[model samples]
Target chain A: MEGNLNALTVVFTEFYYWITVVVMFLIHVGFCMYEVGVSRRRNHMHTLMKNTMVIPLVTVTFYLFGWWIYFGFQGGPGITGGIGDAPFAEPWSALMATHLSGPSPDLGVSGDEAALWSRLNGVFWAAFLLFSWTTASIVSGAVIERIRSGAFWMLAVVIGSFAWIIDAAWGWSSQGWMVKLLGYHDAYASGVVHGIAGGFALGVLIVLGPRLGKFRADGTPRDIPPHNRWLVTIGLFLIYTGFWGFYAACNIPIISPEGIAGQITGETWTATNIYLAPTTLSAITFNFIMSLSGGMMAAYVVSKGDAFWTYSGGLAGIISASAGNDLYHPIQALIIAAVVVVVIYKLHYWVERRFKIDDAVGAVAVHGYAGSLGVIIAGFMLWGQPSSPYEGFATINPLGNFLGAVIMFGLLGFLPGYICARILNAFGILRIPRKVELEGLDFEGDETYNASVAEVIAAEKAMV
Target chain B: MSTNGLTSWAVDLKDVGAIYPFQGTETVLVIILLVFWIGWHVLQTRAETREFEHDLAADKSGDEQRKAIDRY
Candidate 1:
């Protein structure tokens, strides 16, 4: 703690992110509810457990190495510069553990770095960790009712703690190569979080195959209505609410001119997007509501008033516009959202029927397709814009953004997902056995439940 | 040449304001958004009416209605 003003700023920043982490927790809660609601009664327990377990598994692994990857790989090792130094993020760093406001003997962290990290490290890590869990949970929803928990958990770690973090290093970070070279501008992580997760889901689905009975004899897709429409609606609403926190968390709540250390020449304190480019809460708020409204309206018309599609369309709308929401005119966001909803809704069914790949929810369309489209659109909408405040960065262009979208959805998102799923499948652990799947993944739990009920009934009758 | 008229963020933050793209089109954008907001309700009401009509026709026998009530 130096000056009183400086001290207050640090404390405020810390508390700001802490609150965002809390709000973002609702995103997971929403995902769990949404997945459980969509699954049949026989699959409820398994679905809930599958999504819920991503939290602990991804949390532990993220703490172990995920944070390090963000700072360590910012260079693309050579694209922007050499491998950046990020000792504090390393697992063995003393700063990684609880330490007082002083230098450490465990690692070579100086007093200043240690002081800053001592207060900020845990909260920052947590904010990003929530993102990690979200990425993994996105995949979780698409594979519900059929994927084994153990197998899914492994996939969760790959996306949550490894794959997504690597993309964050290359795309989302301020000095990330994509930001430097491609002018990739995903202010709310349309590509970084949703795009990658969506691609990862598609990768897994390609190999995991459709859930039994998802297709008819003519190879046509069937409508698998959610077991509980009320739960699904409520869950989607909660997700919408939690997304406010997600948006806030993507920003530097406050930063001074000196903090940015780039071309941004100013004494004014302000909020910056992930790439250290300026934006406002007011602008993003306008775009968020407008895009959401646009999405819901378009979805209603396109789906002919289907409840599930309407809600999912709203989410898709927000996601489709999220890449440029930081800078988009509110109306531009709305129209873009409307356009993407129609495209994604059509694509969702086309992909389902054409490939017979079952996505339990329209995750691939909502996250993957919308996310990719948002990124490409941002290239044109924000064309000639600086991706980062730093010098030598490429201006935002359609080609750059299109390439970034492909890398996010195809390279980082899908490739690893397919490879890992293939490995899991070879060992006969990817999908559950057909008999158990048909009976439900909760069959074992059901057996125990029945046994307990029979015993309780028998005991009560005897007493009577 | 940038979308918001600033090619770089090198300027002082104190001077910087309203970074959203298409800076002077707020009025037009507002009009468009207003139309969308109003149009949504119009479309939604019509869709809801259609849905109700379909529901009435399909469940004319009242068997499905009874089942729904019973399930509840």
Candidate 2:
């Protein structure tokens, strides 16, 4: 508020994130369209609504506690330290709303708190809120056609507002214990977002079981093609578009060494990843395009030019390289992305055939399997590198990253999801009844649509 | 008479802490919003149950089922 350059930088950073939030909205639009495209004609509306409702439910819940958890649990509340303070994020905090940087004792904050909260709080909270939506939406696709919206909404709140945010606190936060002690690094959340969501979907699917008739008498799986191929491809394309915003949002757009107060020197201002480690958006852009190309090409050959796998491969490709994309060479990113997609593609079928676990959209393979691989692969690729610009944190290594992946995909992602889903199943609210599913989850709504169509047709014939 | 402390805009803008009316009522507003949010879920869940029940009965004729399958 005092000086020109300082004020401009703060305002610029706020506006930068605001734009990213708008762009990231497309990711949800894509998820909604993707689920609708994958569902059969009968189940279309139900599938779309089931995913759509996650928005408001998760937003409200995330506002209630999710933003607080990101700052509060950074310490593991014991491991690295105790619960950290985040007064600005509190629901009742005046800083949560419009305010100038000038002091406000009514809100019970010192001038320092006012300065940070006035500019960054709303946009930062909004940016993270979009990520919460993405995490829950990832689970939405795998459980389509049969999951009760009531049950799914609860699951969305758990993943979007609670479980995933805790993991972000643990791994993605700058002062997080995982980063402090273990050197757990996931720059773009390859494991944190995609891995956890994919695993959560897998856990729910295990208890929810397959859509009826997914497996035959011999226990072989059947292919359920998407009702509309074009929509699925377009959905994936929109996700890729929004992913640009996600990447930019993950960075502190521009910060000086003095601002970060870390090991970085020379007063250089640069874009830093979630851990406040220096990285250029340019470096990640090269890796993003390279990995995506590698995934599409590899998916084409492996799935033999299947449109669905090809598009999903593009997504899996970027996700597989995302962990190291901030630091990786373009060629290195490409190879890693291509290799992970091939392995995940093969594993998807192997799991389906061996376990008879029906993942409707291969979300488990594309997200969970590929994302974990990306995290572990980054360990080898970025070995001996600083996980943060901070002092005394462990250097990036295989063991820490491997454990981080396991914690993300299995421990945090799968375990709670499985337990909660099992409870919901025991109460028999998780999945629709067999008869209702077969007749179609959207049967009544579609019935009304068809009735209206028939009435209109009869009236038109009489006029003619 | 205003819920907000300020009765006029003649005061310096910088002195203003919260512009909205009833600034001190934040906790009350939050409580109300929370009640509305949770109440909405309860009501929606009930409507969902009723809608599912109706759909469950609608397909008893089997004719609609055949038509849907044929359309597929």
Candidate 3:
């Protein structure tokens, strides 16, 4: 609407985010497939539905309050002041609907703000919404089979719409207190998305307990093999593809120095992390592939070429190195990923045995432990580096990021998750009864289907 | 003149901002949508609980449950 340069930038940025939202949809699809694949044949339909419902449920609730939480609570509310203004993200804003980017004085949006947000807001909100679905779906995998659909959906809304979004506000946002005070530097949400979701899943798993027969009378854990290996492999592959979109969504694709209005003073236009610090697509691409390769190779050797663990290790690799991927040398990313996978793989089994907790899909280790480690690793790797381009922000340090990781994985993630799951459990809704668990979640549906088939066959025989 | 406040397309496009119909009633629309969303969870939760309770009442025999496990 203004200069040609401005128009192009706005359109391109808007389209860029829109594309990422589309691609990130694959993450949810992958989750459904992966959960169903891991579940028994008897529980297949129920498992798939459990993950699939996360999409719609999280979407509406996210539209309601999640997006607003991201902008409004960046101050810690308690840290800087109180809940701040975020006119563009408010659910009732005119900009929240279809708009052409002109003046909206009656609606309290200025022409300048409207023009920018009009093109960007929907796509940005959608991209974050997809991340919300991913967060809830991550928990869905670890709690399949025994978790009541009703209870899981309620928990999904909590994490997808409330808990994870709050962590995003506190750590992932540019003006978050974790960044300004603690020098947190999770450029790609190793801690914000993956870490918190993982911890939340762990907390829930502790309360919900394992699937029936997940343990033996002797207290030894059993390895429940996936019902379908092909689906599991394909699901993991799709997640890898969607993760590219997640990484892209984490960046401000292109911005000029003045756009950032921070310490960065240059004529060069560049991509930046969520914190408005400069990075490049090239840097992340190199690290993403390298770390993934490192994770797979290490996991294959460590788990003795177990396909499930190998694929998960590759994901853990990307997540473990994601915090510093923007600045990491590819080899550094690879080495970090390789080492972290071994530790997490062992920790997964250790936690399983020691705590008698059964994680159906190892989500707690792959996402939670790997993600927290990544955030802490970034502080050391990028020590003394500016956490944000903004003046007066704290420099990146180990202590700051360690505390940030704790806030992400423990304070925000585990506490809310444990409390919510406990509430649901106390109400006798968290886990399905032992009778239902043994009979299969789809028992009634399967029985009805069998009866229908028999009746149709009898009718067909009479016609013949 | 229109629900979207557009009488014509004859004017400069730059003057147009919100093009959605019933723009001023966004707050009301949001309120209605919020109620619908929360209502959905309530209904869904009740339905699911009912299904589970019905399944529990139907009460498959021990042998049938064993057979179901074997299907896995």
Strongest candidate by DockQ: 1
So what's the TM-score on candidate 2?
Answer: 0.85
lDDT, each prediction? 0.90, 0.86, 0.86
Number of colliding residue pairs in model 2: 0
Candidate 3 lDDT by residue in tens digits, A1-464? 68888889999999999999989988877888888899999999999888888889999999889999998899978996579788889888888999887775455666767889899999999999998998899888999889999999999999999988988888888898888899888988899898999999999999999887889999999889999988997899899999999999999999887777776554677788898877788888988998898788778767766789999999999999999887776666777898899999999999999998889999999999999999998887777767787877887788999999999899988998899999999998889989989999999999999999999999999999
Question: Which candidate has the highest lDDT of all?
Answer: 1
Taking all chains together, each candidate's TM-score versus the true structure is: 0.96, 0.85, 0.86
Q: How accurate is candidate 1 locally (lDDT)?
A: 0.90
Provide the RMSD of all predictions against the true structure, rounded to 1 decimal: 1.6, 17.6, 16.9
Ranking by TM-score: 1, 3, 2
Number of colliding residue pairs in each model: 3, 0, 0
Candidate 3 runs further than 4 Å off:
B1-72
Tens-place lDDT per residue, model 2, A331-444, is 667678778999999999999999998888899999999999999998776766678877888877788999999999998899878988998988889989889899998889
Could you tell me the lDDT of residue A240 within candidate 2?
A: 88
All candidates: DockQ? 0.76, 0.01, 0.01
